[model samples]
Target: MITGIEHIAVLAKDSKALTDWYVKLFGFEIVYDNGKGTYFVKAADGSMLEIIACSGDCRPTEPKEWGIRHFALSVTEDGFDEMVEKLKVEKVEVVTDVAVSPKGIKTFFFRDIEGNIFHLIFRPTPL
Candidate 1:
């Protein structure tokens, strides 16, 4: 039987700094650190993110490259405003302005410290 997603992988030019960024911004717990740039960070709900280091030889892929487009993280309805302000203060690159779907789901798109795109969502109803 298939279980929930174990984790999603993301490449980073600076793995350590990206790991620190996740910890500082989302309070993600470090699951593993090789002390040589690779790290696994887990969110509050056990969702894990694998942060892999890319060296000088790494070729950057376009945003719409054949794999996963972006990772979406959910924010509580009450914290949605606070999170938006936080992103503004951090000077994060906004990929798209906040918008509401027909289902009334509010969402914002932004890029992470390592230039990976992410979606910030506020769902009125839990899935």
Candidate 2:
């Protein structure tokens, strides 16, 4: 039977830099560094992200890309606001500013160093 997701793989032009970016932004720690362009980072909640080294530059994801549009990392409501502010202070590209839905879910989106769009979501109730 299929279980939870093991990891989400992303291609990075510079694997080491991308790995460091996650470590700096989020609290993700390096679990494995294959020395070749592949690295594994483990998030605080035990989620894993596999970064694969690639040669070409990464382009921002398009909504019609026929694949995953974006992936989100959950954060507390307070953390959500703090993250949005931090992103703004750091001059990072903010795709969508913080907004609260009618259902009370707060979310914001931004781009990473590799041009990957990531969302920070906060749900009043746990999923």
For each predicted model, how many residue pairs clash, with residues at least 3 apart or on different chains?
0, 0
lDDT of each: 0.87, 0.86
Candidate 1 lDDT, 1-127, residue by residue in tens? 9789989988898989999999988889999999888899999999999999986765544577997778999898888878888887889888887898899899988888878889889999988
In angstroms, the error of model 1 at 96 is: 0.6
Look at candidate 1 and give me any clashing residue pairs. none
The candidate scoring highest on TM-score is 2
Residue 114, candidate 2: C-alpha displacement in angstroms: 0.8
Assess every candidate by TM-score. Answer: 0.90, 0.91
Model 1 score (lDDT): 0.87
Task: Please write out the lDDT profile of model 2 over residues 1-127, one tens digit for every residue.
Answer: 9888989998888889989988888879999999898999999889999999886656667755877888899998778877788777767788888889998999888888888888999999887
